[model samples]
Target: MILREQLITQGVSEKLLDDVEKFKAFYALTDQNLTSRVPQTETVFYGKDIWAMCISALLEEENILLSGPKATGKNVLADNICELFGRPQWNTSFHVNTDSASLIGTDTFIDNEVKLRRGSVYECAIHGGFGVFDEINMAKNDALVVLHSALDYRKIIDVPGYEKIGLHEATRFIGTMNYEYAGTKELNEALVSRFMTIDIPQIKEETLMVILKNNFADANEEMLSQFAGVFLDLQAKSRNSEISTKSVDLRGIIGSLKTIRRGLKPMLAVDMGVIGKSFDQYEKEIVLDVIRTRIRESWEAEDIFPER
Candidate 1:
């Protein structure tokens, strides 16, 4: 209680301060109390501090952008942020058809009268919660226009027929995207100017191995290293345009390693990890070749396989 008051004294707005109070109370009473649950200590995530800083900035009502390739732990990073901050999160995935009504609020005809139903952004803002806008670049420019007002100095949303609502001080939006990919437009200067962008690097081999060990305690360490190496190799191929971006999946590797530990054959595990990622026959073959070559090399180094 005193801390909340102190936050208000430190220039946090009244609405946000009050919302935080409500959040604290809810946690104390609700069966699913978020505050009581401890954050994960066993799963090691490298560059985790960058996400913490981003969350801190959000607590101060600053906007942020996270740019990274697929399976770089972007969503996990977001989840950890909410867990650490003790805030509820609302997720809004952007696509070509996303519009103002989708972000700001929409009035629906009910009982012959239109009533405003808050969108994810609106609900998160008013409730002093965090919002994650996933794949923000996938949205059309017109769809993002509503955010300019919400994010900028105005810090308010005005629905013509309804009340003008100011943002709660703790309300923050985290936008995630993979900027290097095709079909993603450069974030317009106006929108780009509003955010503090953090470039998330691809997960390193050591970090990936740590994740595997934590997730699969029974797996051979050498085999886990091979799995990580395969993903890194695929990532390099993607970067070089030798293969499409979808070829690499760190999550898939972990899942397949778990399968391998459960007595699945190496080829079967590799298929589980690499084959399903592709929809095209050609892409699948390429991924399979890469996986076989890498895993074979790793196995031979341990004298477990005979070289051709």
Candidate 2:
């Protein structure tokens, strides 16, 4: 099913969809130039309740802050939300060095004349696009002070040498952060208050199996279950502080399946995708042990799936 149909079936209120359509129609009547920034994503976000909550927040014009641990589908849901609303997306990955000039814009000399180079936030604000502030807590609080006005009721971007620009009515900002990640700072209360925060939970075993089946259609149910089990086992280890999260990657599991499909040995493919992610020898050994416990070294494509 298409994204919109999936959303409606997944419990997003009909009114919310109507509101989004109305918002789009209103923008169509205006002369504002809006560039298409929608992302082409293959991942689907499950859980009807979470979909409803996100739709409710956007319809109310509230900025959303998604906080969770790594690989909990945070970025996936952000991209999915943009698709569901049919709005242009401007993804700005925040880091320690991301400054106000990067969020807003900077004056640059071009063609013998000084012109303002609009940044992600600036363009999103004016064009009614969704701005994704990825890993927001990675940046220092002082650097993010400029966002206070834009996020708050003021909804205005104050450029030092330029006129203030009001954000479009349809403009919304979504901030994502992995709270447990190293080097991430606690978001100050002032900045936190401006957004409606949601704590994204880890993907459930059933959901993980669904995702794995969707991606690895050629794999049998038992093998898919084993892959999901391995991921959950690694997740449990990380949660218990037995190892760092560097080795627990959902994407890596899918990557391994793809490599195996290409006729590579299953163990070697899993090693390249899952174990190879960690640079530390100790970490690699730990990850390899998990794989060993899950799949035997003698296992081949026939062991995981029916021969096509």
Candidate 3:
């Protein structure tokens, strides 16, 4: 992999390249060096603009927080940024139980003596990797207080019992959250001020179709288009408040198409792909009717077996 400086020279943003270089140098002296960078992420045409903007901010003095509903590709985008910058990714999936001790390293007993074992965030920061805070809003706000100083202008981390360390110039945190969903809280102002928030809206039908066309080379184009229509129908229902589900993920539809192409019963594919995982029972029943009606009418013409 080329160094961050090389990537910049190759027409990538100077700011982003510099951040990558900083990460490499910072991690080189730490025990948690990833030893390599992320592979070049295949960028989706639909997200290029947003991705570039986010990368530019990350390179300068800002972090990014991606806000969206489920399946909006938040995590995927974060991973892609790390790849584009040739930086290793350190993913930390946040949950209610996550604590500062979990974000930074903790002292634990080893050989009857205390030894420091680095947490996901700390190790990644020291090693110059991108730290992806997945589903960050699910974590208790108090747990993230430790990150305030690290993320802001201070740009340093103080580990009281161990050492006060400064952040690696390359280290940046990209947090992902689904704020519209239940149980998610407002990102605290203190934390919010530190990041450049990018609101990830529902993906376009054309973009989703492109993803399916590219991902499944053998998939029939007609079927792919039909699937995209089905996804939009579901999304429309959600927006109109006629459905309780928040979104119909294009990736799920693609997976369903793959299953059907592999000879799984189409209804069974819809059941696993579109149903059984979202909304409450009444709403789910409504969605099931929609899926069955659409798949049966559209695919049965292709001799795809209908649901019993």
Candidate 4:
């Protein structure tokens, strides 16, 4: 509901909002057990244009792929979309080991009888939940081949040796992949063709401020700006090839701010959240310099958060 209002503040149209409401109403979840799967987000995705585009695509029943560098808020937006539509989310984290059995289903013995153990995608399709495929490119093409029928015009999952199931009308699959992450590879043409790809851009400082305000309301505005600057400076360095995007992390900044709220020193909190991400000593030094330049070595929690 907060994201709906924020979307309005960001100039997303009333029509799109109305459509999302209608979507929620039409595909209402009756499974009480799935209530917990509907995510409650700590942060919101802030781009009105991106929001509108995603709303439009989902309205037309298109599966979308969010393609971008790290920290572009792919998972955040996917989570927000699930929240907006009031859909339960089933998050499938792809890795080298991800395969058909892990995604669809596998058989297991219970009570001396072999029964099908439902997988995330299987459950997601049957319940009309939003399925978020994270780092999809990391999985082998053959592994994801099981999803072809489910994602295409057929809209069905045909499990071998079991009954084929139709995807619930409200079901939408959202895939996200980073541009340059370890153990990731190109998505094969067949897999890529199924998605309406949305290229996510880097977060702007203004948007970053709004996110910070949303998550850390007690934090001072100047301190929030400084935190935002830390990310942006790292982003600038990344763009110029001075450093990899590994240290230019939005989540790290948010986590650092959270640790600061818990009375950790600014530099140490950033060290854990941002600087520690890069294992390379040279990279860590660069990240440290970028962060220390924005936030002094001696800044305290009181400097960032005001009295409650």
Best by lDDT: 4
Candidate 4 Cα errors over 4 Å, as ranges: 109-115
Q: Is candidate 3 or candidate 4 better by TM-score?
A: 4
Q: In angstroms, how far off is 76's CA in candidate 3? A: 1.1
Looking at model 1, residue 108 earns an lDDT score of 92
Instruction: Give lDDT: candidate 4, residue 266.
Output: 88
Candidates sorted by TM-score, best first: 4, 2, 3, 1
User: Which is the winner by lDDT between candidate 2 and candidate 4?
Assistant: 4
lDDT for residue 298 in candidate 2, whole number 0-100: 90
- Residue 220 Cα positional deviation in candidate 1, in Å, after optimal superposition: 1.5
lDDT by residue for model 2 (47-112), tens:
777777787898889999998877778899999988767678899999999999999999999999
The full ranking of all candidates by lDDT, starting with the best, is 4, 2, 3, 1
Residues 1-308, candidate 4: write the lDDT tens digits.
58788789889999999989999998887778887899988677888888988999999999999998887789989999999999999999999999999999999999998878999999999999999999999998999999999999999999888899999998999999996887898799998899899999888878788888888989999888988998999989989998887888888998999999999998899989999888989988898888877899888888998773
lDDT scores in order: 0.70, 0.85, 0.73, 0.90
Candidate 4's displacement at residue 299, Å, is 2.2
Which residue pairs come into collision in candidate 4? none
Task: Write the residue-wise lDDT of candidate 1 on 196-221 in tens digits.
Answer: 88888877776677677667655556
